[model samples]
Target: MEWLVSGLIFLHVTSGAVALVTFWLPLLLPKGKQAHRVTGRVFAISMIVCGVIAMVLASFHLTSPQWVEGAADTRLQLGWMMLYLGLLATVLVLFGLKTVRNKGRHHLYKTTWILFLHGALALLAAWVFWLGWSQRELLLIGVAFIAFLMVPGNLRFILRKPVAAPGKLRREWLYQHFTSMIGAGIAGYSAFLSFGAAMYMPTHAFNPYLWTIPTILGVSFMMWLSKRQPRYD
Candidate 1:
């Protein structure tokens, strides 16, 4: 069982690293280029593999507490963290893919489904925060807040109106594509910073500054890059 967990960890880390690297290639390359498409495919596949393996490994931790060598409380905390991170990363990437494909007007059914998921997640996060406050679990409270923030964007999709064609008036699909991909990139970076390279960081590395770095950088870069996109004229 130990060996199996170790193998899953190795697979998860390796795929995540691949995703982290390949995700940048498409951002640098011109849109609609073959290289961009190929690299984007690689990045998407790697992210899916990484997310799936991460959840599987987290399940192992949750089911077999004896297999974990850390303090019992710490192990349990880590298990829940893994599950949350895995779900977040996987769902975010999947939604990013969906956004790119949704070039037409938003469908009520699709938006409603997504809205339901985000609403449920937001409620869950609120419950977690309340529970954490009662239990004095600072980590849980912090994570729950982050989860709450993630839901707001999904909420927007439900309220958004139909958009014009590409470059006509509001290039909604293009904007969504840009935002979703950059959001995925932020998630990839955060995972790497929190887990892959965590050994090099200080013990008190879970602060807001550390967690928000990827998001801040990614959004700034996206704004600049989107400006460079060719106009319809």
Candidate 2:
């Protein structure tokens, strides 16, 4: 049971890592649609199972006993678990509701939003877990509140009519995004593996923000230099 739980967590992390690396590449590259969709299905299933099993095992986890005064502070693990649950619920809600009616405008916008939410939060959590940092609640709460404000701005950016044609936009930005995705994915997956492996006692799971020097540096470097923009605007 111990290995089984840990194995599932590991598999989940692996899938997430693979997906992240490939996430943008497929969109902007000449990948087969069928293959992409099939992989997406696999990722979705893996994530759901990971979420459910994590919740169930949270009870049996003897490392951090639930909410003590200050013996070891298991609440950090619980907080991450809750975040996991929230991510799971958000994905299910988005995938569950599908409609042909909201085609042109409403459908596109809603689907876009839900997909954005899922990807954003999932990737964000992945990055956080990878670093094994401190879970300062005040910072997280403030970030969350500000994040909501950024959502609409992001949506606008995605849904806006592009000045360039589809083909041109694809040509111009695909490689850059693909590069960044791979770099980001590596950093995030490393975090996931590290967290699961180190979940031994003072697991850095609850530290909210990631703090590992390597991961922190890797993420920073990737974000700063992942993609090279073409000189010709």
Candidate 3:
């Protein structure tokens, strides 16, 4: 059982590292190019792999608390947080990839599975919020607030018919793709900083603010990127 957890952790860290590196490649490279597409695909797959492993690890933490080296309540809280993050990462990457694939065809993107994913996240966000409020955990509350903001926009994007011009529709897809992929990067970096880096550093030396650094930087960059309308070639 210990070996299994270690193996999952190893895979999760390796894949997350790959994702963090590749997440920037597509943005740095010329968009719509072959290299950009290949790197983007790699990043998306890495994120999915990492997210799945996280969910599995979370399950172990939740169901087999004896294996986890923490207080029972702490383990349970961490398990739920990990599971939420895992689902968030998976959904973001899939949504980003789907936007690109369904370019100009918004209807194709509004599948039942996508809707279900959003719904699940929404419910999870509320539960996390409640948990955070009850426990007075600011991080979980902040995360839930962000989730609340995101899920609605995603749902609106899928449900709303594209009444705009064809070019506008294309741009909307590009924007969503950029936002979702970068958002996944933010999650990846936050987890690494908060959890992975903490493992190496002394508990007292680790600043909780490190968790918000990625989010602030990522969101600022995303906003700047959103302003520049790149050609959707």
Best by lDDT: 3
Residues 99-175 of candidate 1 have per-residue lDDT tens digits of 66765456732665666656655675676577567767665576665556556765566466664566565545565
State the C-alpha lDDT per candidate. Answer: 0.67, 0.42, 0.82
Which stretches in model 2 have alpha-carbon errors above 4 Å? 1-154, 165-187, 190-194, 201-215, 224-227, 231-233
Candidate 2, residues 35-129: lDDT per residue as tens digits? 75455444344445444544444444434354222334444444454454335433432332221122223324445566566567656555434
TM-score of each: 0.78, 0.42, 0.92
Tens-digit lDDT track for model 3 on 96-127? Answer: 99998988787798799999998998898799
In model 3, the Cα lDDT at residue 113 comes to 97
lDDT-best of 1 and 3: 3
Worst lDDT 10-window in candidate 3: 197-206
- Badly placed stretches (over 4 Å) of model 3 are 165-170, 202-208, 230-233
